[model samples]
Target: MALLTYTPEIAEARDKGHPIVALESTIITHGMPWPQNRDMARQVEADIRAAGAIPATIAVMDGEILIGLSAGQLDRLAQTQDALKLSRADLAIALATGRTGATTVAATMICAQLAGIEVFATGGIGGVHRGAELSFDISADLQELAQTRVTVVAAGAKAILDLPKTLEVLETLGVPVIAYGQDALPAFWSRDSGLKAPLRMDAPAQIAASHRMRARLGLPGGQLVANPIPAADELPSAMLSPLIETALSEAAAQGISAKGVTPFLLRRIFELTDGASLAANIALVRNNARLAAEIARALA
Candidate 1:
């Protein structure tokens, strides 16, 4: 039996050569709560459609990699309590065991490439954790970008991470971090991270052209398009920094580590901010989906 299964919509899109954007399932399974997660997933898929592309929200279930999910499947995933958070390390294990799993940024990239889809949209990419110098905890998302061929469009590295270390590691790995229409890298929910981006591209077509050029040159990795959150939707870095620090402190005191750290910090920050963080996250994800759709159209 094949390891991959495509939803009818995605299969049709592939057969017709329609532009398609890949979406990570973690945002639905692990990022938000029940109804809201389902709502956000639907909204993001709609945003891609509105921008002239099809959305392939990737997940794993019943020993198969699902390139896209139906509405019922999305709902079930959003409500499932024990979905494994599959990354590069354990994606195949989850597949072999037929466990339901949400694809993280790294897993999504691998699955997207396997499906021959070259663009993925997500709220943010994971990166070096704040205390990573001691913990040595870097995200596989960074390593995945260093080798995968699917271009990722994200607000930026999740703000709870150490942005400088993340950028340094990406630079060391030779991954192109291109800030879209901006000089500074975006800080997930914030429009600016105060760190200058190494590369910048203002248009979707330009991004697509660069992706093609990389393929022409036989590059091993994909480009990271740091699409800033819309100005109106952003939580200023100044306002968000203190909340992030508080969340980080709480997580450290609680002994949270590994994958648990992100969810804990995000949930804590959302509570500390009175839910503004999740609202901004939803906005940024939709924004990224729109841009990824445009880039996918250009690639097509």
Candidate 2:
């Protein structure tokens, strides 16, 4: 009956009822350049540990659904090329075949739920792309949040996405989008995306209490905690908006559509911003790790 498996560390944490936060593997295998990616992965895990929780960075390898990775696994993953980016639909196939794969936001949530982890932390979630209307392209993360009962703390949807539409879809799915200590939603690297969040909660205890309430009320899904990047790390909407526009224009010109849009835009944005975007991403992810730890501790 146990279709999925966990690493020893994660299994022990689960047995001990320790506070554990789930991290996606895509950030290591696909998010950044090597060495930096491995370093950032360790740093985020350390941040969670410092905040009194264990980190479970989920991935699939050698026919096992690895709930946490060792240093060697992380280093190898970062250096390995063409790691299959697995999502909800492909998660089982990857595991069954023993293929090495990185977990996206949606797949990570599923793994977290399977591991009995209540919270997840990540840099930014994938969402509605710029041309969703025409291309019908949207990220499965939105629907995943609406069904999985794991609270996710993220900076917000990536700025390259259609922010307003993504928010709309989350609302339609009845997902609670709570901005942490802020009135407006964050736009990944930016402090504010100029759109007001559906709800706001300042304390991790309050967020934890809300998670309990969702269970009490028999809610199907989880909450979206949108934490803004720190002022010093924020790229500001002013800078990001134009860069996003340029990236979208370039994508349009090249006819980059569907699944290719996100990676294409992110690569172009990295070049356009001279790596500032990547830096901000790492900062926000660590920040989310800290908050997610607090929530997990409260849940414990």
Candidate 3:
């Protein structure tokens, strides 16, 4: 019922049967600093539009879901320091309590499905965290992809996660994880994770048709189109390993875990790479948006 009160520009696009892509808002509030966060948000939307689709950046604000945010709201959210990062479990609570929050990958998928946006573009999917056996920290995004009827276009799982375990869970859930063009699954910021992709599709048409077929079969979930980062922008998994190790050590030493873990690691990597990670982040997100647009267009 609360989902019904949500309204934003993308709602009009949905009603009109236009191509629309769902975008997550955590990148604005938790991924980076204010000005850059707002800038990146705008650029991702621009990328989606340039690729011939409307972008719906999802968030919860003042007891309502915002399917797409205006520039001013985006700016304010990016600058607000204490905004909650919400996922499926907490999304309803945030909405019922009239709390403003940024939607994470999991929350975004749920909202996108409710809004009737069949395609979502994001930088990467969260997965089984490092040390999962002990920490038991798993991302809800994996389960979200299993039942939310919205195709998500992302580079791949973040490299800091246990990629092997992530793939195993995705497989167990009956989620379709299809690589875009390569035989290997991409590691966010890296073109190849050294693991062969379970499935691969080269064209947007094929991916869209598969989505349609799934619906025809009464399937409950969506597809994970694992688009690789542009070759020119890839950081190479080998090169990122040492840097990631250093960042992970820093995170552990600082007692950072759970949600705090990702942002901490990213910030450390940003400083470690002298901004290369951020640049790669921007590039891959835009690339995913473009690919998601193509899929949306194909769906149309």
Candidate 4:
């Protein structure tokens, strides 16, 4: 039996050979609460459309991988409770068990490549956690970027992570971390992570050309376009550092580990910042979506 289901919009886009940017669904199901998530999803999709590309928001439902979702489906997904947060390891399990799952960066890239889509957008990619040497708790996203052939656009690795360690791992994996129009890598809610980017590309066309060049050279893995969040929406890293440190400390005290770490940090940060972090998140995601659309068009 076929495992893929393309929403009508995505099917039409595919038929026409139009540029389609893949979006991960975990942002809808796990990133925010209720109506807000739905609204953000809709707005991001609209932003992509306005930028002249199709949006393919990927997820797993009823034993199949959905390349895109209809309006009703997207609404249902945004309201879904207990949806599996699937990555490379568990994506197949969710499909085999006919369970609903929201794809993370790694899983989304896998799905996008399978569907012949070449570019993906997300708020941020998971990476090395703080004190990873002892915990050895690195995210699967790093390994996925090393093997996948899709170009991923994001603000950067979450500010809650060890950005330096994350960059080191990405370098080790041979994943090109290209800062979009900047010299510094972006931290999720912050415009700068206080670290220099390994590569910088100013134009979407240049990024697209690099992606094609990689494939032509028989290189494995994808490119990470670290698109910085807009200045007006960013929370300066100087202000966020203490907040993130406090959240991290709280998580350690509470013994939160693995999958629980990110959500716990985000929630704590939201409370600490009076919901400002969430607003910044929404803005950065929409910004990334717009850029992803441009890159997709360039690739096409």
TM-score of each: 0.99, 0.97, 0.97, 0.99
Q: Which stretches of candidate 1 lie over 4 Å from their true place?
A: none
Which runs of model 3 end up more than 4 angstroms from their true locations?
1-8
lDDT of 2 by residue, 1-300 (tens): 366677787788989999999999888887888788999999999999999999998888766777888888888888878788889889889887878889999999998898889999999999988778988889999999999999999999998899999999999999999999989999999989989999999999999999999999999999999999988999978877888899899999998876667778888888999999889888999999999999999999
Clash count, one per candidate = 0, 0, 0, 0
Q: Residue 176 of model 3: what lDDT?
A: 96
Error of 1 at 109 (Å): 0.4
Clashes of 1: 0
Q: Give the Cα lDDT of each candidate.
A: 0.94, 0.90, 0.91, 0.95
**Candidate 1 residue-wise lDDT, 38-105, digit = tens:** 99999999999999999999999877899999988898899999999999999999988889999999
Q: lDDT by residue for model 4 over 276-299, one digit each (tens)? A: 999999999999999999999999
Clashing pairs in 2: none
Clashing pairs in 3: none
Q: What value does the lDDT take at residue 269 in candidate 1?
A: 85
Clash-forming residue pairs, model 4: none
